[model samples]
Target: GLKGPENWGMIEELASVLGAATACSKPVSDIGWRPHSEHVGQTGKPVAANLYIAVGISGAIQHIAGINSSKVKVVINNDPEAPFFKVADYGIVGDAFDVVPRLIEKLKEFKANNA
Candidate 1:
């Protein structure tokens, strides 16, 4: 959400970078760029990914209800007290715009090293 139209393209790019399947909050699916099958929210599909990275998404109890079973829950939010942090295995208190780019860079590094 932080990025402009051009950078929004990066969200798709990042999906490949992370080897992550794209999932979204309800609003994004309502607009229809992604399928409802990939939606993660109380009224949508539940995710059981090995890693769940939530950014800018506030942890409404409803959202938490969907993803609590993830093996590793990592939350990135500027607000330190966001409820998602309460259930997250790792929490990053920072702007997601900055953090996500750095995280993508680091993940690329991680993949390179592991490969």
Candidate 2:
């Protein structure tokens, strides 16, 4: 529900800075916010990344099944009771709008310090 079309740019930026591939829930693709090729879930593409970060996904069973092979899973959502948390190595309970920007800032800071 939090996958605002307006936020796509920031999301793409997040993926770029993280050196991560971008994928989305079935609904996001179904609604045409993203291409079907970018959809990942039981009914879509399966992912086996070393690290997977799911933002704003509510963790439907199908979605979890597809990403289960990921070595590490992190979930960000506003709902503390979101099912994704059950399988996540780390979970952040907050609005994506607020949490994502802060996360990006922190990552950039860490990158600068380590560089």
Candidate 3:
């Protein structure tokens, strides 16, 4: 779970580098893993970012409803059958531990080269 302190720093770093807002699923918020202010779903905050990336989320109907307005949706989940993939413009079926670090590296490289 992303509630782990070890993973939280990486998530925050990635979001900071991407200049993106961070949000959490209802379950995460309800469980007190994340603050309710960051919750994104039918019962929480709505998201309409140009690019929405869902990592490790199962994409419940309420979650989908909140993020459906995003111009592009990217889903990364280890489960190939995760519902998030059905609505995603790009899908990566892999462990977040393996995928996120590589993604962060690539994004950093891109930023460095483009900057």
Using TM-score, give the best candidate's number.
2
Question: After superposition, which runs of candidate 3 have C-alpha atoms over 4 Å from their true positions?
Answer: 1-5
Residue 99 shift from truth in candidate 1, angstroms: 0.5
In candidate 3, the residue pairs with backbone N, CA or C atoms under 3 Å apart (3 or more residues apart, or in different chains) clash, namely: none
- The true-versus-predicted C-alpha distance at residue 81 of model 2, in Å, is 0.9
Candidate 2 lDDT over 1-115, as tens digits, reads 5656778877888888899889999999999899999999999999999999999999999999999999999999999999999999999999888988899999999999999
- Model 2 residue runs over 4 Å out of place are none
lDDT per model, in order?
0.79, 0.91, 0.87
TM-scores of all predicted structures = 0.83, 0.96, 0.94
Angstrom error at residue 70, model 3: 0.5
Ranking by lDDT: 2, 3, 1
Clashing pairs in 2: none
Candidate 3 lDDT by residue in tens digits, 3-115:
46457676777788899978989998887777999999999988999999898898999999999999999998999999999999999999888888899999999999999
Q: Candidate 1 — which residues are off by over 4 angstroms?
A: 1-7, 31-34
